[model samples]
Target: MLIFWKPRLALLAVPKTGTTALENALASSADAAIVNPPGLKHCTVRKYRRDLSGFFEQKGKRPLSLVAVMREPVDWLGSWYRYRGRDALAGQENSTAGMTFDAFVQAYLQDNPPACAKVGSQAAFLEGGVDHLFRYDRPSDLIDFLRDRLGQPVEVGRANVSPDGDLTLSRQTRAALETGRGADFELWSAL
Candidate 1:
Protein backbone atom coordinates (compact mmCIF):
# COMPACT_ATOMS: atom_id res chain seq x y z
CA MET A 1 0.00 0.00 0.00
CA LEU A 2 1.89 3.01 1.30
CA ILE A 3 5.66 3.48 1.24
CA PHE A 4 7.62 6.60 1.83
CA TRP A 5 9.48 7.70 -1.27
CA LYS A 6 12.22 10.30 -1.24
CA PRO A 7 11.00 13.73 -0.03
CA ARG A 8 7.88 14.23 -2.12
CA LEU A 9 6.33 11.35 -3.99
CA ALA A 10 3.75 11.70 -6.75
CA LEU A 11 1.75 8.71 -7.68
CA LEU A 12 0.87 9.65 -11.26
CA ALA A 13 -2.43 7.87 -11.16
CA VAL A 14 -2.99 6.11 -14.42
CA PRO A 15 -6.66 5.19 -14.45
CA LYS A 16 -8.37 1.83 -13.97
CA THR A 17 -5.20 0.19 -12.76
CA GLY A 18 -6.45 -0.37 -9.26
CA THR A 19 -5.59 3.28 -8.65
CA THR A 20 -8.44 3.98 -6.25
CA ALA A 21 -7.57 1.00 -4.13
CA LEU A 22 -3.92 1.93 -4.05
CA GLU A 23 -4.72 5.57 -3.29
CA ASN A 24 -7.12 4.56 -0.53
CA ALA A 25 -4.60 2.30 1.12
CA LEU A 26 -1.86 4.90 0.94
CA ALA A 27 -4.08 7.68 2.29
CA SER A 28 -5.07 5.51 5.22
CA SER A 29 -1.66 4.12 6.13
CA ALA A 30 0.93 6.77 5.36
CA ASP A 31 1.58 10.48 5.01
CA ALA A 32 0.24 10.45 1.46
CA ALA A 33 -1.35 13.65 0.21
CA ILE A 34 -3.77 14.32 -2.60
CA VAL A 35 -3.52 17.20 -5.03
CA ASN A 36 -6.50 19.41 -4.42
CA PRO A 37 -7.33 20.96 -7.75
CA PRO A 38 -9.93 23.71 -7.64
CA GLY A 39 -13.13 23.11 -9.63
CA LEU A 40 -11.88 19.94 -11.18
CA LYS A 41 -13.50 16.52 -10.87
CA HIS A 42 -10.15 14.74 -11.08
CA CYS A 43 -6.49 15.32 -11.85
CA THR A 44 -4.74 14.39 -15.02
CA VAL A 45 -1.04 14.46 -15.80
CA ARG A 46 -1.80 16.74 -18.74
CA LYS A 47 -3.53 19.10 -16.33
CA TYR A 48 -0.59 19.18 -13.94
CA ARG A 49 2.65 17.99 -15.56
CA ARG A 50 3.73 21.28 -17.09
CA ASP A 51 2.70 23.11 -13.93
CA LEU A 52 4.03 20.61 -11.40
CA SER A 53 7.13 22.44 -10.30
CA GLY A 54 5.22 25.59 -9.45
CA PHE A 55 2.53 23.60 -7.74
CA PHE A 56 5.15 22.05 -5.53
CA GLU A 57 6.74 25.43 -4.97
CA GLN A 58 3.41 26.90 -3.89
CA LYS A 59 2.91 24.05 -1.47
CA GLY A 60 6.41 24.62 -0.07
CA LYS A 61 7.22 21.05 -0.97
CA ARG A 62 10.20 19.97 -3.00
CA PRO A 63 9.79 18.60 -6.48
CA LEU A 64 8.45 15.10 -6.19
CA SER A 65 9.95 11.89 -7.39
CA LEU A 66 7.20 10.42 -9.53
CA VAL A 67 5.94 6.86 -9.80
CA ALA A 68 3.18 5.37 -11.95
CA VAL A 69 1.57 2.01 -12.49
CA MET A 70 0.96 0.71 -16.02
CA ARG A 71 -0.88 -2.31 -17.18
CA GLU A 72 -0.52 -4.28 -20.39
CA PRO A 73 -2.58 -2.37 -22.94
CA VAL A 74 -4.60 -5.39 -23.94
CA ASP A 75 -5.62 -6.30 -20.41
CA TRP A 76 -5.88 -2.69 -19.36
CA LEU A 77 -8.25 -1.76 -22.12
CA GLY A 78 -10.20 -4.92 -21.57
CA SER A 79 -10.90 -3.96 -17.99
CA TRP A 80 -11.65 -0.42 -19.08
CA TYR A 81 -14.15 -1.59 -21.64
CA ARG A 82 -15.90 -3.93 -19.26
CA TYR A 83 -16.10 -1.32 -16.55
CA ARG A 84 -17.41 1.27 -18.93
CA GLY A 85 -19.77 -1.19 -20.53
CA ARG A 86 -21.28 -1.90 -17.15
CA ASP A 87 -21.69 1.78 -16.45
CA ALA A 88 -23.16 2.42 -19.87
CA LEU A 89 -25.80 -0.15 -19.11
CA ALA A 90 -26.29 0.69 -15.49
CA GLY A 91 -29.64 2.44 -15.78
CA GLN A 92 -30.93 0.84 -18.94
CA GLU A 93 -32.39 -2.59 -18.70
CA ASN A 94 -32.20 -3.49 -22.37
CA SER A 95 -29.62 -1.19 -23.80
CA THR A 96 -26.99 -2.42 -26.15
CA ALA A 97 -24.46 -1.89 -23.44
CA GLY A 98 -21.21 -1.58 -25.34
CA MET A 99 -19.58 -1.35 -28.68
CA THR A 100 -18.50 -4.29 -30.72
CA PHE A 101 -14.88 -5.32 -30.20
CA ASP A 102 -13.73 -3.73 -33.43
CA ALA A 103 -15.56 -0.53 -32.64
CA PHE A 104 -14.03 -0.45 -29.20
CA VAL A 105 -10.59 -0.94 -30.64
CA GLN A 106 -11.11 1.84 -33.13
CA ALA A 107 -12.43 4.21 -30.51
CA TYR A 108 -9.66 3.29 -28.15
CA LEU A 109 -6.94 4.09 -30.63
CA GLN A 110 -8.43 7.03 -32.48
CA ASP A 111 -10.55 8.83 -29.92
CA ASN A 112 -8.38 8.62 -26.82
CA PRO A 113 -11.55 8.85 -24.74
CA PRO A 114 -11.93 10.88 -21.59
CA ALA A 115 -12.03 7.76 -19.50
CA CYS A 116 -8.32 7.47 -20.25
CA ALA A 117 -7.48 11.15 -20.27
CA LYS A 118 -4.53 11.19 -17.86
CA VAL A 119 -2.70 8.45 -19.70
CA GLY A 120 -0.64 10.17 -22.32
CA SER A 121 0.62 9.09 -25.66
CA GLN A 122 2.82 6.02 -25.29
CA ALA A 123 5.93 7.78 -26.55
CA ALA A 124 5.81 10.30 -23.73
CA PHE A 125 5.38 7.75 -20.99
CA LEU A 126 8.11 5.52 -22.42
CA GLU A 127 10.60 8.36 -22.60
CA GLY A 128 11.14 8.36 -18.83
CA GLY A 129 9.81 11.78 -17.97
CA VAL A 130 8.67 10.24 -14.72
CA ASP A 131 11.07 8.90 -12.13
CA HIS A 132 9.78 5.34 -12.38
CA LEU A 133 7.11 3.19 -14.02
CA PHE A 134 5.62 0.10 -12.40
CA ARG A 135 3.44 -2.69 -13.74
CA TYR A 136 -0.06 -2.88 -12.34
CA ASP A 137 -0.41 -6.54 -13.24
CA ARG A 138 2.69 -7.29 -11.18
CA PRO A 139 2.24 -5.11 -8.13
CA SER A 140 4.79 -6.83 -5.88
CA ASP A 141 7.64 -5.59 -8.05
CA LEU A 142 6.08 -2.14 -7.97
CA ILE A 143 6.05 -2.23 -4.20
CA ASP A 144 9.65 -3.44 -4.11
CA PHE A 145 10.75 -0.75 -6.53
CA LEU A 146 9.06 1.90 -4.41
CA ARG A 147 10.62 0.44 -1.28
CA ASP A 148 14.06 0.66 -2.81
CA ARG A 149 13.42 4.22 -3.94
CA LEU A 150 12.03 5.19 -0.53
CA GLY A 151 14.60 3.23 1.47
CA GLN A 152 11.74 1.73 3.41
CA PRO A 153 9.68 -1.44 3.45
CA VAL A 154 6.14 -1.46 2.02
CA GLU A 155 3.22 -3.83 2.26
CA VAL A 156 1.77 -4.41 -1.22
CA GLY A 157 -1.32 -6.48 -0.79
CA ARG A 158 -5.04 -6.52 -0.05
CA ALA A 159 -7.83 -4.48 -1.59
CA ASN A 160 -11.15 -2.93 -0.53
CA VAL A 161 -13.13 -4.45 -3.37
CA SER A 162 -12.17 -7.70 -4.99
CA PRO A 163 -11.60 -6.67 -8.59
CA ASP A 164 -15.14 -7.32 -9.75
CA GLY A 165 -14.86 -9.04 -13.10
CA ASP A 166 -12.25 -11.07 -14.92
CA LEU A 167 -10.91 -9.19 -17.91
CA THR A 168 -11.10 -10.74 -21.33
CA LEU A 169 -10.20 -9.43 -24.77
CA SER A 170 -10.99 -10.88 -28.12
CA ARG A 171 -7.96 -12.27 -29.94
CA GLN A 172 -8.34 -9.84 -32.81
CA THR A 173 -8.60 -6.93 -30.45
CA ARG A 174 -5.55 -8.08 -28.53
CA ALA A 175 -3.50 -8.46 -31.68
CA ALA A 176 -4.55 -5.04 -32.93
CA LEU A 177 -3.89 -3.27 -29.66
CA GLU A 178 -0.52 -4.94 -29.41
CA THR A 179 0.44 -4.11 -32.98
CA GLY A 180 -1.06 -0.68 -33.33
CA ARG A 181 -0.56 0.43 -29.78
CA GLY A 182 2.73 -1.33 -29.55
CA ALA A 183 4.42 1.68 -27.97
CA ASP A 184 2.16 1.62 -24.96
CA PHE A 185 2.52 -2.13 -24.72
CA GLU A 186 6.27 -1.81 -24.96
CA LEU A 187 6.37 0.78 -22.22
CA TRP A 188 4.90 -1.68 -19.77
CA SER A 189 7.12 -4.42 -21.15
CA ALA A 190 10.20 -2.33 -20.47
CA LEU A 191 9.16 -1.94 -16.86
Candidate 2:
Protein backbone atom coordinates (compact mmCIF):
# COMPACT_ATOMS: atom_id res chain seq x y z
CA MET A 1 0.00 0.00 0.00
CA LEU A 2 1.12 3.56 -0.75
CA ILE A 3 -0.15 6.60 1.11
CA PHE A 4 -0.26 10.12 -0.28
CA TRP A 5 -0.70 12.42 2.68
CA LYS A 6 -1.13 15.53 0.57
CA PRO A 7 -4.17 14.20 -1.14
CA ARG A 8 -5.20 12.02 1.80
CA LEU A 9 -5.30 8.85 -0.26
CA ALA A 10 -4.40 5.24 0.32
CA LEU A 11 -3.71 3.15 -2.76
CA LEU A 12 -4.62 -0.36 -1.77
CA ALA A 13 -2.60 -3.05 -3.51
CA VAL A 14 -4.71 -5.77 -4.99
CA PRO A 15 -2.45 -8.62 -6.07
CA LYS A 16 -2.19 -9.63 -9.74
CA THR A 17 -3.90 -6.40 -10.71
CA GLY A 18 -1.04 -4.16 -11.88
CA THR A 19 -0.74 -2.41 -8.50
CA THR A 20 3.05 -2.87 -8.47
CA ALA A 21 3.25 -0.71 -11.54
CA LEU A 22 1.26 1.99 -9.78
CA GLU A 23 3.43 1.69 -6.68
CA ASN A 24 6.60 2.09 -8.72
CA ALA A 25 5.25 5.03 -10.66
CA LEU A 26 4.07 6.94 -7.61
CA ALA A 27 6.56 5.94 -4.94
CA SER A 28 8.50 9.20 -5.16
CA SER A 29 5.41 11.20 -4.28
CA ALA A 30 4.00 8.93 -1.59
CA ASP A 31 4.49 9.73 2.09
CA ALA A 32 4.70 6.08 3.08
CA ALA A 33 5.34 3.02 0.96
CA ILE A 34 4.77 -0.43 2.41
CA VAL A 35 6.38 -2.75 -0.11
CA ASN A 36 7.49 -5.73 1.93
CA PRO A 37 5.93 -8.33 4.17
CA PRO A 38 3.31 -9.54 1.74
CA GLY A 39 0.52 -9.27 4.27
CA LEU A 40 1.11 -5.56 4.82
CA LYS A 41 1.98 -4.90 1.20
CA HIS A 42 -1.38 -6.36 0.27
CA CYS A 43 -3.32 -5.12 3.27
CA THR A 44 -7.00 -5.73 2.87
CA VAL A 45 -9.70 -3.05 3.13
CA ARG A 46 -10.94 -4.52 6.41
CA LYS A 47 -7.50 -4.33 7.98
CA TYR A 48 -7.01 -0.79 6.77
CA ARG A 49 -10.35 0.23 8.18
CA ARG A 50 -9.75 -1.53 11.46
CA ASP A 51 -6.10 -0.73 12.03
CA LEU A 52 -4.92 2.21 9.94
CA SER A 53 -7.81 4.39 8.92
CA GLY A 54 -8.22 6.19 12.22
CA PHE A 55 -4.53 7.04 12.50
CA PHE A 56 -4.46 8.53 9.01
CA GLU A 57 -7.66 10.39 9.52
CA GLN A 58 -6.73 11.83 12.92
CA LYS A 59 -3.02 12.36 12.36
CA GLY A 60 -3.31 13.64 8.84
CA LYS A 61 -6.38 15.72 9.77
CA ARG A 62 -8.28 14.28 6.83
CA PRO A 63 -10.05 11.11 5.92
CA LEU A 64 -8.21 9.10 3.30
CA SER A 65 -9.87 8.08 0.12
CA LEU A 66 -9.07 4.45 -0.53
CA VAL A 67 -8.51 3.25 -4.09
CA ALA A 68 -7.85 -0.13 -5.64
CA VAL A 69 -7.75 -1.88 -9.01
CA MET A 70 -9.45 -5.17 -9.61
CA ARG A 71 -8.98 -7.60 -12.47
CA GLU A 72 -11.52 -9.88 -14.10
CA PRO A 73 -11.98 -12.97 -11.94
CA VAL A 74 -10.90 -15.54 -14.51
CA ASP A 75 -7.96 -13.46 -15.65
CA TRP A 76 -6.98 -12.90 -12.02
CA LEU A 77 -6.89 -16.66 -11.41
CA GLY A 78 -5.04 -17.20 -14.68
CA SER A 79 -2.36 -14.73 -13.58
CA TRP A 80 -1.95 -16.64 -10.31
CA TYR A 81 -1.76 -19.92 -12.17
CA ARG A 82 0.93 -18.59 -14.48
CA TYR A 83 2.77 -16.80 -11.69
CA ARG A 84 3.11 -19.93 -9.55
CA GLY A 85 4.25 -21.95 -12.55
CA ARG A 86 7.51 -20.02 -12.85
CA ASP A 87 10.76 -21.97 -12.91
CA ALA A 88 11.91 -20.27 -9.68
CA LEU A 89 9.26 -22.07 -7.64
CA ALA A 90 9.56 -25.49 -9.23
CA GLY A 91 9.95 -27.55 -6.07
CA GLN A 92 8.05 -25.42 -3.59
CA GLU A 93 4.80 -26.51 -1.99
CA ASN A 94 3.14 -23.43 -3.48
CA SER A 95 4.36 -24.16 -6.99
CA THR A 96 2.06 -24.84 -9.91
CA ALA A 97 4.90 -25.97 -12.17
CA GLY A 98 3.14 -28.88 -13.80
CA MET A 99 -0.49 -28.01 -13.39
CA THR A 100 -2.72 -26.98 -16.27
CA PHE A 101 -4.72 -23.77 -15.96
CA ASP A 102 -7.93 -25.75 -15.55
CA ALA A 103 -6.46 -27.85 -12.77
CA PHE A 104 -5.04 -24.80 -11.02
CA VAL A 105 -8.43 -23.13 -11.10
CA GLN A 106 -10.11 -26.29 -9.90
CA ALA A 107 -7.78 -26.32 -6.93
CA TYR A 108 -8.52 -22.65 -6.22
CA LEU A 109 -12.25 -23.28 -6.18
CA GLN A 110 -11.97 -26.16 -3.77
CA ASP A 111 -13.39 -25.83 -0.23
CA ASN A 112 -9.83 -25.60 1.03
CA PRO A 113 -7.40 -24.67 -1.71
CA PRO A 114 -3.91 -26.08 -1.81
CA ALA A 115 -1.00 -23.70 -1.23
CA CYS A 116 -0.59 -22.91 -4.91
CA ALA A 117 -4.22 -21.83 -5.18
CA LYS A 118 -4.74 -20.24 -1.81
CA VAL A 119 -4.90 -16.65 -3.01
CA GLY A 120 -7.89 -14.85 -1.53
CA SER A 121 -10.49 -13.32 -3.82
CA GLN A 122 -10.60 -9.60 -4.71
CA ALA A 123 -14.11 -9.22 -3.37
CA ALA A 124 -13.04 -10.53 0.01
CA PHE A 125 -9.97 -8.29 0.10
CA LEU A 126 -11.91 -5.13 -0.64
CA GLU A 127 -14.90 -6.11 1.45
CA GLY A 128 -14.67 -3.23 3.92
CA GLY A 129 -14.73 -0.96 0.85
CA VAL A 130 -12.83 1.61 -1.21
CA ASP A 131 -13.76 5.13 -2.16
CA HIS A 132 -12.46 4.68 -5.67
CA LEU A 133 -12.14 1.45 -7.62
CA PHE A 134 -10.75 0.83 -11.10
CA ARG A 135 -10.50 -2.11 -13.44
CA TYR A 136 -7.12 -3.58 -14.38
CA ASP A 137 -7.81 -3.82 -18.11
CA ARG A 138 -9.06 -0.22 -18.25
CA PRO A 139 -7.28 2.33 -16.07
CA SER A 140 -7.80 5.68 -17.77
CA ASP A 141 -10.23 6.86 -15.12
CA LEU A 142 -7.82 6.02 -12.33
CA ILE A 143 -4.93 7.64 -14.18
CA ASP A 144 -6.94 10.79 -14.64
CA PHE A 145 -7.93 10.89 -10.98
CA LEU A 146 -4.35 10.45 -9.81
CA ARG A 147 -3.02 13.01 -12.25
CA ASP A 148 -5.54 15.58 -11.13
CA ARG A 149 -4.93 14.93 -7.47
CA LEU A 150 -1.16 14.47 -7.52
CA GLY A 151 -0.51 17.23 -10.03
CA GLN A 152 1.77 14.86 -11.96
CA PRO A 153 1.29 12.55 -14.89
CA VAL A 154 0.67 8.98 -13.76
CA GLU A 155 2.51 6.50 -15.95
CA VAL A 156 2.15 2.90 -14.89
CA GLY A 157 4.76 0.75 -16.55
CA ARG A 158 4.89 -2.97 -16.01
CA ALA A 159 6.35 -4.16 -12.72
CA ASN A 160 6.21 -7.64 -11.22
CA VAL A 161 4.25 -8.67 -14.29
CA SER A 162 3.31 -12.28 -14.84
CA PRO A 163 4.79 -14.25 -17.72
CA ASP A 164 2.83 -14.34 -20.94
CA GLY A 165 0.75 -17.43 -21.67
CA ASP A 166 -2.54 -18.53 -23.08
CA LEU A 167 -5.04 -19.65 -20.45
CA THR A 168 -7.93 -22.00 -20.99
CA LEU A 169 -10.29 -23.58 -18.47
CA SER A 170 -12.62 -26.52 -18.88
CA ARG A 171 -16.33 -25.74 -18.98
CA GLN A 172 -16.95 -27.74 -15.82
CA THR A 173 -14.20 -25.96 -13.88
CA ARG A 174 -15.39 -22.57 -15.12
CA ALA A 175 -18.88 -23.40 -13.98
CA ALA A 176 -17.60 -24.46 -10.60
CA LEU A 177 -15.58 -21.27 -10.20
CA GLU A 178 -18.58 -19.13 -10.97
CA THR A 179 -20.75 -21.11 -8.59
CA GLY A 180 -18.22 -20.98 -5.77
CA ARG A 181 -17.19 -17.37 -6.28
CA GLY A 182 -20.39 -15.62 -7.19
CA ALA A 183 -19.47 -12.56 -5.12
CA ASP A 184 -16.42 -11.88 -7.29
CA PHE A 185 -18.49 -11.97 -10.44
CA GLU A 186 -21.09 -9.73 -8.88
CA LEU A 187 -18.52 -7.19 -7.74
CA TRP A 188 -16.73 -7.14 -11.09
CA SER A 189 -19.98 -6.72 -12.95
CA ALA A 190 -20.95 -3.80 -10.70
CA LEU A 191 -17.60 -2.19 -11.36
Candidate 3:
Protein backbone atom coordinates (compact mmCIF):
# COMPACT_ATOMS: atom_id res chain seq x y z
CA MET A 1 0.00 0.00 0.00
CA LEU A 2 1.12 3.55 -0.75
CA ILE A 3 -0.03 6.57 1.21
CA PHE A 4 0.43 10.05 -0.18
CA TRP A 5 0.06 12.38 2.75
CA LYS A 6 -0.14 15.58 0.79
CA PRO A 7 -2.81 14.21 -1.49
CA ARG A 8 -4.65 12.52 1.39
CA LEU A 9 -4.88 9.40 -0.71
CA ALA A 10 -4.27 5.78 0.23
CA LEU A 11 -3.74 3.26 -2.51
CA LEU A 12 -4.93 -0.15 -1.41
CA ALA A 13 -2.92 -2.95 -2.93
CA VAL A 14 -5.25 -5.56 -4.30
CA PRO A 15 -3.33 -8.73 -5.10
CA LYS A 16 -2.36 -9.65 -8.69
CA THR A 17 -3.43 -6.23 -9.90
CA GLY A 18 0.03 -4.86 -10.66
CA THR A 19 0.30 -3.16 -7.26
CA THR A 20 3.96 -4.07 -6.90
CA ALA A 21 4.76 -2.03 -9.95
CA LEU A 22 2.70 0.87 -8.60
CA GLU A 23 4.45 0.70 -5.27
CA ASN A 24 7.85 0.67 -6.95
CA ALA A 25 6.93 3.64 -9.11
CA LEU A 26 5.36 5.73 -6.35
CA ALA A 27 7.37 4.70 -3.29
CA SER A 28 9.67 7.70 -3.45
CA SER A 29 6.74 10.09 -3.44
CA ALA A 30 4.54 8.37 -0.91
CA ASP A 31 4.49 9.56 2.68
CA ALA A 32 4.42 5.93 3.83
CA ALA A 33 4.91 2.72 1.87
CA ILE A 34 4.15 -0.76 3.14
CA VAL A 35 5.81 -3.18 0.77
CA ASN A 36 6.73 -6.03 3.05
CA PRO A 37 4.76 -8.87 4.66
CA PRO A 38 2.31 -9.78 1.91
CA GLY A 39 -0.65 -9.39 4.22
CA LEU A 40 0.17 -5.77 4.94
CA LYS A 41 1.16 -5.03 1.38
CA HIS A 42 -2.21 -6.24 0.16
CA CYS A 43 -4.33 -4.71 2.91
CA THR A 44 -8.01 -4.85 1.98
CA VAL A 45 -10.74 -2.23 2.32
CA ARG A 46 -12.27 -4.01 5.31
CA LYS A 47 -8.97 -3.97 7.17
CA TYR A 48 -8.36 -0.35 6.28
CA ARG A 49 -11.83 0.63 7.47
CA ARG A 50 -11.46 -1.29 10.71
CA ASP A 51 -7.88 -0.37 11.46
CA LEU A 52 -6.00 2.19 9.39
CA SER A 53 -8.80 4.57 8.59
CA GLY A 54 -9.01 6.00 12.08
CA PHE A 55 -5.25 6.07 12.33
CA PHE A 56 -4.90 7.98 9.10
CA GLU A 57 -7.64 10.38 10.07
CA GLN A 58 -5.85 11.13 13.32
CA LYS A 59 -2.41 11.44 11.79
CA GLY A 60 -3.29 13.18 8.57
CA LYS A 61 -5.98 15.32 10.23
CA ARG A 62 -8.47 14.16 7.60
CA PRO A 63 -10.02 11.03 6.18
CA LEU A 64 -7.92 9.52 3.44
CA SER A 65 -9.50 8.67 0.13
CA LEU A 66 -8.92 5.04 -0.74
CA VAL A 67 -8.10 3.81 -4.24
CA ALA A 68 -7.77 0.28 -5.60
CA VAL A 69 -7.46 -1.75 -8.79
CA MET A 70 -9.31 -4.91 -9.78
CA ARG A 71 -8.93 -7.41 -12.58
CA GLU A 72 -11.50 -9.57 -14.38
CA PRO A 73 -12.49 -12.54 -12.20
CA VAL A 74 -11.62 -15.39 -14.56
CA ASP A 75 -8.34 -13.83 -15.67
CA TRP A 76 -7.53 -13.17 -12.02
CA LEU A 77 -8.08 -16.85 -11.24
CA GLY A 78 -6.01 -17.84 -14.28
CA SER A 79 -3.15 -15.76 -12.89
CA TRP A 80 -3.38 -17.62 -9.60
CA TYR A 81 -3.44 -20.95 -11.40
CA ARG A 82 -0.40 -20.12 -13.45
CA TYR A 83 1.42 -18.56 -10.48
CA ARG A 84 1.03 -21.66 -8.33
CA GLY A 85 2.00 -23.79 -11.30
CA ARG A 86 5.50 -22.32 -11.25
CA ASP A 87 8.36 -24.73 -10.53
CA ALA A 88 9.07 -23.10 -7.17
CA LEU A 89 5.88 -24.58 -5.70
CA ALA A 90 6.20 -27.93 -7.51
CA GLY A 91 5.58 -30.29 -4.59
CA GLN A 92 3.62 -28.00 -2.26
CA GLU A 93 -0.03 -28.50 -1.49
CA ASN A 94 -0.62 -25.00 -2.83
CA SER A 95 0.97 -25.91 -6.13
CA THR A 96 -1.18 -26.17 -9.23
CA ALA A 97 1.39 -28.28 -11.02
CA GLY A 98 -0.05 -30.78 -13.50
CA MET A 99 -3.52 -29.35 -13.06
CA THR A 100 -5.55 -27.96 -15.93
CA PHE A 101 -6.92 -24.41 -15.74
CA ASP A 102 -10.40 -25.88 -15.65
CA ALA A 103 -9.62 -27.93 -12.56
CA PHE A 104 -8.02 -24.95 -10.84
CA VAL A 105 -11.07 -22.76 -11.46
CA GLN A 106 -13.43 -25.52 -10.31
CA ALA A 107 -11.50 -25.71 -7.08
CA TYR A 108 -11.80 -21.94 -6.75
CA LEU A 109 -15.61 -22.13 -6.99
CA GLN A 110 -15.76 -24.51 -4.04
CA ASP A 111 -17.32 -23.33 -0.78
CA ASN A 112 -13.98 -24.00 0.81
CA PRO A 113 -11.30 -23.83 -1.84
CA PRO A 114 -7.91 -25.46 -1.42
CA ALA A 115 -4.90 -23.22 -0.96
CA CYS A 116 -3.99 -23.27 -4.63
CA ALA A 117 -7.36 -21.83 -5.64
CA LYS A 118 -8.21 -19.70 -2.60
CA VAL A 119 -7.35 -16.35 -4.08
CA GLY A 120 -9.72 -14.00 -2.26
CA SER A 121 -12.56 -12.27 -4.05
CA GLN A 122 -11.85 -8.74 -5.23
CA ALA A 123 -15.40 -7.69 -4.42
CA ALA A 124 -14.92 -8.86 -0.85
CA PHE A 125 -11.65 -6.96 -0.62
CA LEU A 126 -13.32 -3.71 -1.60
CA GLU A 127 -16.67 -4.39 -0.02
CA GLY A 128 -16.64 -1.06 1.78
CA GLY A 129 -16.09 0.74 -1.52
CA VAL A 130 -13.26 3.15 -2.33
CA ASP A 131 -13.01 6.75 -3.44
CA HIS A 132 -11.56 5.53 -6.72
CA LEU A 133 -11.26 2.13 -8.37
CA PHE A 134 -9.55 1.22 -11.62
CA ARG A 135 -9.90 -1.80 -13.86
CA TYR A 136 -6.65 -3.60 -14.48
CA ASP A 137 -7.51 -4.06 -18.17
CA ARG A 138 -7.49 -0.27 -18.53
CA PRO A 139 -4.31 0.77 -16.74
CA SER A 140 -4.14 4.16 -18.43
CA ASP A 141 -7.07 5.31 -16.33
CA LEU A 142 -5.14 4.54 -13.17
CA ILE A 143 -2.04 6.24 -14.55
CA ASP A 144 -4.04 9.34 -15.26
CA PHE A 145 -5.50 9.36 -11.77
CA LEU A 146 -2.09 8.95 -10.19
CA ARG A 147 -0.48 11.61 -12.34
CA ASP A 148 -3.19 14.13 -11.56
CA ARG A 149 -3.40 13.34 -7.86
CA LEU A 150 0.31 13.09 -7.25
CA GLY A 151 1.12 16.09 -9.46
CA GLN A 152 3.88 14.11 -11.15
CA PRO A 153 4.48 11.90 -14.13
CA VAL A 154 3.75 8.36 -12.95
CA GLU A 155 4.82 5.27 -14.82
CA VAL A 156 4.22 1.65 -13.87
CA GLY A 157 5.65 -1.48 -15.49
CA ARG A 158 4.39 -5.03 -15.20
CA ALA A 159 5.50 -6.85 -12.10
CA ASN A 160 5.01 -10.30 -10.56
CA VAL A 161 3.61 -11.73 -13.79
CA SER A 162 2.65 -15.40 -13.54
CA PRO A 163 3.71 -18.05 -16.02
CA ASP A 164 2.37 -17.64 -19.55
CA GLY A 165 -0.19 -20.11 -20.93
CA ASP A 166 -3.57 -20.49 -22.60
CA LEU A 167 -5.84 -20.71 -19.57
CA THR A 168 -9.14 -21.89 -20.98
CA LEU A 169 -11.85 -23.17 -18.66
CA SER A 170 -14.19 -25.96 -19.60
CA ARG A 171 -17.78 -24.93 -20.33
CA GLN A 172 -19.12 -26.66 -17.23
CA THR A 173 -16.45 -25.17 -14.98
CA ARG A 174 -16.98 -21.70 -16.44
CA ALA A 175 -20.69 -21.95 -15.79
CA ALA A 176 -20.07 -23.02 -12.21
CA LEU A 177 -17.66 -20.16 -11.60
CA GLU A 178 -20.05 -17.63 -13.06
CA THR A 179 -22.88 -18.87 -10.86
CA GLY A 180 -20.86 -19.41 -7.71
CA ARG A 181 -18.99 -16.11 -7.91
CA GLY A 182 -21.78 -13.85 -9.06
CA ALA A 183 -20.66 -11.02 -6.80
CA ASP A 184 -17.24 -10.96 -8.45
CA PHE A 185 -18.75 -10.94 -11.91
CA GLU A 186 -21.18 -8.21 -10.93
CA LEU A 187 -18.48 -6.03 -9.46
CA TRP A 188 -16.20 -6.46 -12.45
CA SER A 189 -19.05 -5.74 -14.83
CA ALA A 190 -19.98 -2.57 -12.95
CA LEU A 191 -16.36 -1.42 -13.15
Superposed by TM-score, candidate 3 places the C-alpha of residue 101 at a distance from the truth, in angstroms, of 0.6
Question: Per-residue alpha-carbon lDDT of model 2 for 4-91, expressed as tens digits?
Answer: 9889889999999988899889988999999889999999999988888888778556889999999999999989988988889999
CA RMSD of each candidate after superposition: 4.9, 1.2, 1.2
lDDT of 1 by residue, 24-126 (tens): 5465544545624421213344544555445653555566666677777766655555555555455453222445535555556664443422234444443
lDDT of 2: 0.90
* Global lDDT of each candidate: 0.56, 0.90, 0.90
lDDT at position 150, candidate 2: 87
User: Candidates' TM-scores?
Assistant: 0.67, 0.96, 0.97
In model 3, the Cα lDDT at residue 78 comes to 86
Off by over 4 Å in 1: 1-6, 29-32, 35-46, 57-61, 87-102, 111-128, 147-153, 156-172
RMSD of 2: 1.2
Candidate 2 regions with alpha-carbon error over 4 angstroms: 59-61
Q: Which residue pairs show backbone clashes in model 2?
A: none
